[model samples]
Target chain A: MATIEELNKDYSKENNILKKLTSPGGLKDKITQFQADLDLAVKDFKEKKKKKEYALSRNDRATADMLEKDLETIRKNVLDLRDKIQKASDFLANQQKIVDEKFEELSKDPEIKQKLDSILYKKYDRKKKAELNKKQQLETIKQIVDAHPNIQKWLKGIEGYEKSIRKCDKIIDKYKATPPSTPEEQKDLSDAIDEKNHSTKSLADRRSDLVDYFAKNHPEIDKNILENIHSYGNIDRQIAGCEKSINNYDKAMDNLSVAKDTNVVNQTSPSSLAPVPAQKPSWFHPIQRLKYSINEWRARRTQNIEPNPIEPNASAKSTFLEDVKLSKDEYNSEIVQKYLNEQYQENLHKVARQKGNDSNERGE
Target chain B: MENDFINITNEDLEKLSLEELADLKIELDDLVSKVNDMLKTCDDILNKDN
Candidate 1:
């Protein structure tokens, strides 16, 4: 059995090679290089044709003939380059498939699988921690905002305006429903319309005030809280990315295991190598049609059965009231600067922690 | 002619041990380098002045 140190070393070595094999500068680049060379050769042939024309204009048949021969050689070489490019492209595709398979095999090894899992887990763990921290911070913010009487009143006031606007909308609808038969009715309808517009304008103003209050009074707290709230989406994306990588690893392993089982079955039963006959439809039988329909329904149901996805933690569930959409101007306010500074510090701490983890893994 | 080259699939590679995979990687690297060199030579020949 390999020790942890030996396993780590082997994993790193193999991982590096795998990275190189898949890198842009690897075998794939050869095809690109060949195509580029072919383009240059074609361009050169065009220039040579111009030279041939000039030679002909001077009545230099020998020179013209020589240039034409050179052109023919260039044309032949260009064709050969194109052929090489095609071959190289096919070769790269074949090799890439092999490399991908090798990678899958490497990942399936117990030690390598553990190493890969640990790396993925660490990433997922970090994002999960960040997400939890953000949630807790948001909860604290919510508590503080909820506790404050003035903030509560302001929020209520904003809600009141929204409610009033809705009420005004109903009034407007009532006024709009009866077509004004007299000048007095028309004046009443106009007044109602004007009132609704006033309420709408006030609602906008009130929301803006609330935003300004947060920016001015609780800039740091509000910035951190709102920024964190906004960043839940980003963290979710990062976590999902990590999950996808881990899922892909598992999927590859599953495929390998399935392949192995199939191979074993094939080895055990030589008769299974023969293709099964296709089912023939009997149009004369109603019972057979019903059975076929039932089978088709079952197949469709099975196809529709998707695996349940991983759900976000309870803390990540946000309320409608908490989904505050910051305006462009507000997002770019002093709060943004504070948020950016806080993010920079957080990133620095994360990088330092990552470095420490790397060193610890290396046993340095 | 290309078919003459050994066509090792995923199944073939899966059966090999880790050490053999590593050795195979080295051989692959050497082959890739040779191909690259051949391409470079072809590029030079194409670009060469008469």
Candidate 2:
């Protein structure tokens, strides 16, 4: 039978083991997670193939383009996962190195382990709690969004209109071969023809943009458009509550009012459409304040000189060109071919001169 | 002479003709199938032991 003190000591050891095991630099860890996103991409590709084979020129092509965008998203997710893992590992290594150096420094003090024992490993636990809360909030917010009638109506409207666009493509392909018949048919044809004209950057292009946005690099874009795209369901909520209603206060309008007053998303990042700067992190690092300020000292001493890029040599330029439409062999051989042509012409001129000299000798 | 797997770059893959992607696609599919088979075998063993 263990005493309360003994139980506490046992539990502490167990927690320590878990901490060590899950630590960023541990032999076994959860910090470096391999993503299943590429597998999802493969599944998307397979599903797209099936749709292509069966759907022919059906309205499903729009859906197929969306699926391709989904594949791109999955690819970007895998890349992001890898990048995060690499960054975590690098940070862990740097911290461990600093700790090792500090440990050596602290060895002279003789009470280093006692000091280290006071520190608790609770950051991952806090991160987990935050994640759980965010997920719960996202679900709660999503329900609020789904309850909006306009959003539901708008989503439903998309498929029917998108179907019209796809039908237009098929009809244009067919109608071009055979002329228009009825007056209604002619009108439909005209609309489809217009959709076909400027529709290259249509729904699919916007979808691809979304995939790129939630992607690995997450390149910057027009915030308004990104917000509109991401908040597809949210927009529906806004419209149903505030702008679209019969009374002085619409449901869409009411939601929009709440949105303006409150920071809707705890809005943790710069990517947030509506930003609250109080919670914002500093753009530069802070730890330099506590330390000897290496950056400040270096800034005073060092010149702001940029390193020069290597200039390409004539031979290397001919041998290895970046994004050259022509191949290395073709470009090199073309130059050689030109030189040969010039040399051949020179030889012909020399031969004619010699013949004239021989003719003069014969005349003498 | 043996070649390491990492010798190929993304640019090389991009430059490959459709015929080349088709050839690599076959190889990638085979590798993916083998990986799936191995995963299933390991899962079965673990399940039985557990």
Candidate 3:
């Protein structure tokens, strides 16, 4: 059996491989890149075909045919690569489960559990410190923005617009709930909605101005940070979210202990400790024994029988080419037909110009 | 070709001869095979205990 440290090392190594196979610039990305290349090749072929260049020369036609074949083969290869990646991903996932089980078993030891707890506590401490530093940074930004009168005015305008919009919303909601029966009430609701819309537009304009102000005067400050500066409620919500995540981490650690207890209980449970029943004696019944022997012989005979081999269809040779031709026909019917119509219109215009030119010459 | 397969462009593919396209297909096949080999190695390592 592998030790906990060894298992952890192996698991980490496997995870790196999995990351390489799935991360950006990895096999998945490479396949997507190849697919993009194939799409481009197909598009180029279509353009060439549209220009009737493929029919101009045997070499061009051969190249087009080769492009189509290569495209199909590359597409199949991409799909095969995707399948292989999926299999590798699944295998890695299973490996993760095995490693987790091993870790769970090892963690049952008090020494290991203590070490894990200390590590987790240290991580939690670091996270808490990071969050505190972020809060301090946000506070400093807020202070700087508050000291700037122009930005403060912009924030105040936005706040006033938001407040008026909220009031309008309340009026609108009240009218909608009771449903205005009188013309006066209807007018009141419509007025409220118009006012709300005006305020919303004004609010958006103010926000845009604020963004512009930051761009011109305070290009050093991040626009995103400036946008969030006035929204203390959003800052509070973010803090709450962070706290919730930390609480969840704590819960998970507690659940680990609970899980260990459950495992222990399950190991000693009645079902798992159930005794195995004795096998049936052969001498109990002759008639039943003969029936069993006949059934076993029949099973053996069926297992020995060979299945008939399937014959290959001779006509399947041209199927791929036919499919390619069908696709090309579909393409031509849509895009090439449009091109032909344009050419016909241009020819008609030329003929009309020729007639006008001849008439002028005859008159002169 | 293997090193810069990702850099292969539409214009490049468009200009390639039939024989060159065939060669590209072979390169793609080799890339897939290499990835498969890596996967197999990882699998062997993971299942060594089993």
Q: Which candidate is the best by TM-score?
A: 3
Best DockQ among the predictions, by candidate number? 1
Give per-residue CA lDDT, model 2, range A283-339, as digits (tens). 433332212233343353245422432232353233223323334454445444564
TM-scores of chain A across candidates = 0.25, 0.22, 0.31
Local accuracy of candidate 3 as per-residue lDDT tens digits, A1-364: 9999999887665334334444687655665443333333333344544444454455566676665565455345445545555554454344344434544654689887655444444344344444444444455555656688776677777766866785687688897789999999999899999999998998888889877876786565456655543343334444453454455445544554333454443433333322323335657564454345435544764576435321233332233224333334533454434534554565467667777887999999
Interface RMSD, all models, one decimal each? 8.9, 22.4, 19.8
Clashes counted in candidate 3 amount to 0
lDDT, candidate 3, equals 0.51
Query: lDDT order of candidates, best first?
Result: 1, 3, 2
Task: For model 2, state the Cα shift of residue A333 in Å.
Answer: 92
Clashing pairs in 3: none
CAPRI verdict (incorrect, acceptable, medium, high) for model 3: incorrect
Q: After superposition, how far is residue A109 of candidate 1 from its true place, in Å?
A: 21
**Winning model by lDDT:** 1
User: Candidate 3 chain A — worst ten consecutive residues by lDDT sum?
Assistant: A309-318
Better of 1 and 2 by DockQ: 1
lDDT of each: 0.53, 0.41, 0.51
Q: In model 3, what lDDT does residue A363 have? A: 100
lDDT of 1 by residue, A1-364 (tens): 9999999877665444444444566443544445445444655676798899999999999999999899878767765875675575467557656855776766878888554444333333333334444444445456656667775565555555655665566566876787777898788777777877887787667656556767886654445444222111223333343344444434433443233444433333323222223436455464454345445644764577445422323321121113323344544556444544554565567667777887999996
Give the residue spans of candidate 3 off by over 4 A: A1-130, A215-222, A229-364, B1-50
Relative to the unseen true structure, what is the Cα RMSD of model 1? 34.1
